[model samples]
Target: MTELVRATSGRSEVALTFHGAGDLDITRQVLAALAQHGAYVTVLAVGTWLAARPDAAKMVLDGGHELGNHTWSHPALSAYKPEPMRVEIERCRDELVELTGSPGAFFRQSQGQHATAEELLEAGKAGYSRVLSYDIDSLDWRDPGPAAIRHAVAAASAGSVVSMHLGRPGTVIALPGILTDFARRGLTVVTASKLVS
Candidate 1:
């Protein structure tokens, strides 16, 4: 099957997913904002980041967010050969399993591009059912300020899977406004797994 970019469940719901691997302080801020709005997200975490801060797994899961593999070093997985690619995917999966008792439900590649055939194969080897992708991107990593980030995600609608980054303060700043906009539009924000389900 192809990578999932959006859900076709015919519901007025959207998923907010973040590229995980950032400062713990910023992550805490992002979680606090989401908690304030009673929203949940999926964090596709980098393995190096997880190794550096193993507590981050509990921090994310405890805040009602789930974790997924984004590879070991956040490199473009497609650039590597099959052996290294498998290592990247499985390494991150191992980290997740070690910390959270599971490899998570999805595998999202570094850089948030659509998964390649090789990526899907390696991901399957690592125990992922689907490669989670996104239809909308907030571009918060560019640090274009909160307004730009909000404007970018403002395009989300039902079935939209929005791509965001967790390591940036701009995302944390723009999150509440984005959630407010969704609330005003009568849309429900859900975790990626929920959106796909």
Candidate 2:
């Protein structure tokens, strides 16, 4: 199996990970916000986004960012059996391949849960080598306030994979600040592939 090349530069690095939750507006804002900084971003997109919002999917791909599968429907992988899990993963991958014209080589399992290594193998079989397992939990998934989001990223370090959601306003509001903070600390903000490559 081809292993996703992780960044071993030994310099302090961090990946700003965003899980795309069918939110085109948020994704657009994020891309625009990060472009000025030349930040490398990883966006995990759901299969439904392709059919329901192709425009959003196109926007993400057009940003020259790395896209990863987030499954057909956003559900915990631990909730389903192997066949169903495989189906979900593949469906998302195939849809992404069709839409973006690139087979998704990375994945971020729904809710960050994988019951076993077999699941990782399944991902590998589907041509996904890099899987994002977060290091910093922004808790933005819980609909927290901006202060909380700011506080969490402020504590990130090199190689830290920050979990964020485009669905949350707090996260969006906090992102610009986070990027500025990363700059102030002399750390390069990169994609998840950079962390585990």
Candidate 3:
């Protein structure tokens, strides 16, 4: 599988990936907005988030989008020793597999940090084929206004993997404009797997 920082699809399509570790209400709003646009996205969910709200994880999959592992508690895997790093990756993979009945297709490092060589090997050992990083970060975590969020997403080009968060209300608020911008640019927003595949 490709090590994806940006999708390399030969089409005017991009992936909108949401990191799910924060507010559930905002997550629901984000999902609803995507559904309204008839857009499918990838959600890299925290294992603990899924454990606390399996229903939300189900909601993502049931909506016909893809869900992926984002570690157990959003820890920095690079800071940990090898064994604990494996646990961080594997525990999330296991939890997602149990909840979804399949090991997810991709793994994203916490905070959009690229995995180190050793960490990448650990991810492979944990059964993940691709480690997803992003080309465009929405910076929604800063509680930036909707306009700023829209501007960040607007800068994404074709085959871009745009990082966003489910924890922030600004992201939810910016969804309509983001979708509109993509549509206006004739860029179809697809799930990350679909974009890469």
**Among these predicted structures, which one has the highest TM-score?**
1
Residue pairs with colliding backbones in model 2 are 5-197, 6-196, 6-197
Residues 1-197 of candidate 1 have per-residue lDDT tens digits of 45899999998899999888889999999999889989988999999999999989999999998898899998878888988998999999999999999998789988646888888888887778799988898989899999999999999989999989978988988999999999999888889889888
Ten-residue stretch with the least lDDT total in model 1: 104-113
Q: Rate the local accuracy (lDDT) of all candidates.
A: 0.89, 0.75, 0.87
Candidate number that wins on lDDT, 2 or 3: 3
Error of 2 at 41 (Å): 0.3
Q: After superposing candidate 3 on the true structure, give the runs of residues whose Cα lies further than 4 Å from its correct spot.
A: none
Superposed by TM-score, candidate 1 places the C-alpha of residue 87 at a distance from the truth, in angstroms, of 0.3
**TM-scores for all candidates?**
0.97, 0.89, 0.96
Best-to-worst order by lDDT is 1, 3, 2
Off by over 4 Å in 2: 1-8, 113-115
> In candidate 3, what are the lDDT values of residues 92-150, reduced to their tens digit?
88889899887787898885456677778888888888999888889888988999999
lDDT of 2 by residue, 1-197 (tens): 33232344667888877787746777778888889788878888888876688776677667767788888898778567788888888999988888888766477778753325656777777777666566677888877787888888887887677778776777778888888899999888877766665
- The better-scoring model by lDDT among 1 and 2 is 1
User: Candidate 3, residue 34: CA error in Å?
Assistant: 0.5
- Ranking according to TM-score, highest score first: 1, 3, 2
